[model samples]
Target: MLAMSSNPDSPRVLICDDDAEIREGLVQVFERAGFTAYAAPDVAAMERTLAAKGADLIVMDLMMPGEDGLSATKRLSGKGAPPIIMLSALGDDADRIVGLEIGADDYLAKPCNPRELVARARAVLRRGKDADQPAKSDSVRFAGFRLDVARRELHDPDGVVMPLSAGEFRLLRAFVERPQRVLSREQLLDYAFDNDSEVFDRAVDVQVSRLRKKLERPGIEVIRTVRGEGYLFAVKPTS
Candidate 1:
């Protein structure tokens, strides 16, 4: 425990980076912004910190001396894992894809503006909140596949809950919230990612494929690809 603050109102965020300067700088930024920031040098220390003090989010550097951030992300992707913002010099398109593919909630290039970093962190938290949310919905049920908004779970006829990534959950939730409506990838990205930045349609397609595997049940065509239009969730809801 790094001396808990008496003010219990602030959310705690864990910062893991190999660079001392980067660690201290981020700590200062977070604390100045009304957050409790814990710094660690590696994933081992991060694990220790998480064990002692739970975090609302994690800001991690990708290239550490020992186990890299990617390894850490994969390990931490279990159920109810906290949101993560990966920082790295590898800001190439491929690197971002890999980071997102392996459960990272967001990515930021190093030497980034601190304000942008803070904004991205908040955005990630929002996305996390959105994923775990159970908003009022029509309770869509199609061909034995069930989406329960109140439960925030996808269920098969066997009554087994399906695992969904934060991204996958948001995408499906957007569709289930408004069934039989054709949504282009851009619109889906706007709601699911909550980003104004234009996202390629292939990204949505990939997420749909992943979601389909999770919703693998009989007689359900939850996501239908429409030629020259977009994808639609063709199902009526049930109680």
Candidate 2:
């Protein structure tokens, strides 16, 4: 049996790929796995479908005919965007890093195992829902930024909301929860991902890099690399 999310309802997923066979196959795979799956031929169709009926997550192909997956990924990941799992034929570290950098919650090389894909989808959806659940009125403040833990929101000093993926939110949570403490790659992974997800050390590095780009500013080094030790959250947060 496929893994299920904590919510009883099956999550909705949209697969955007140019290949008809591949798209249809993935749609069947997700449906059999108990997801409400939809298929789109390209970014345009994906946008149209989403406009009509939003999905909980997206499974996008990296190399499409019109607006490649990277661009679409960037456009789709923002303050209200659904989680995305990118599928790419190019199975290089650089390619995966780019996808992660652009806010894809997960990355799977093309021709991936359907079972693994289902597992990844479940993991991402679970994390996203967890992040959205509001806790008590608790917020963390540091370096002119505010992290509303309950609402899973990060806001700039100007009160503008910044977009964050589930993985990014977890990493930042680990940092803010333990300011000035250096956490090893293993520890960061432990904090950021559930046991069901198989993420490597290099993947952690890519996530930190992307998080830095989002939070870093002049004289505001939120996260610092501790050379061989690991990474340290430089700013001290106040509750």
Candidate 3:
């Protein structure tokens, strides 16, 4: 049976999954973890619920009947919506990278431990709330790619917007801010995650690889790995 929590102070979480059993199971987990959880069977229901009552976080499944998670995630991201954690039955680096590129805050493979999901939810919520604060203007432009720190957005040379997850944006920001500097993994994590993110070192590598792919273009190589050192933003970015 699906369980709902009635705590006003609890964060509101909306889970969108096609499987009834999985939906109910996640709802029970979230409720047990002190969140006011709601479940939707698909994207349509998820949208309706969000339109009626806003959500603090969204747990979305990757595969759905009509609109897949990537499409829904892109739509939500374009609107600057709430944080989202994508769950997928396919546990692969490519899937996780794609989810993040579409603006998911986190990605977890299905059959995930409920406790770990709770921890990720808490961490993502913490970062989301922190990001909601106003900040100073900071932007870096190089090779036609612009990193807008204030907006946490990336714009291509053609002025097209490229969606980036929180971690991806932050990592790129760290690089552009310190162009031509070789930063170790520890330094990168400190700058990007602020030591508060749940991501680890190998995950940092994955994010870098993904960001590099986005920033790469003809005759322009933005990032380079130093064998024993770390990574360097090879170009001199302009503010």
lDDT of 1 by residue, 1-239 (tens): 23233346787888999888899889888887778888898899888988888889999899998999999986776356677889999987677777776767777878899988887777877777776665675365766877766556677777788666567767888887777888887788887888525234655666777776776556667678888887888776565
Clashing pairs in 2: none
* Residues 1-239 of candidate 2: C-alpha lDDT, one tens digit per residue: 11222333778898899998888888888888988888899999998888887789999999999999999998877656788899999988788878887778888997899999999999888877666665333698889999988777899888888888777888888788777989999888776766434467788898898888889778878899999988999988887
Model 2 per-residue lDDT at 148: 88
TM-score of each prediction? 0.86, 0.88, 0.75
Residue pairs with backbone overlap in model 1 = none
lDDT of 3 by residue, 1-239 (tens): 23467898899999999999999999999998899998899999898888887789999999999998889997887466778899999887777767776678788988898998998899888876665444333776888887776787789999998877676766776787677989998898777765644445666787899889988899877899998889999998877
Per-model clash counts, in order, read 0, 0, 0
Give the range where candidate 2 is weakest over 10 consecutive residues by summed lDDT.
Answer: 1-10
Question: Order the candidates by lDDT, highest first — what do you get?
Answer: 2, 3, 1
Against the correct fold, how does model 2 do in TM-score?
A: 0.88
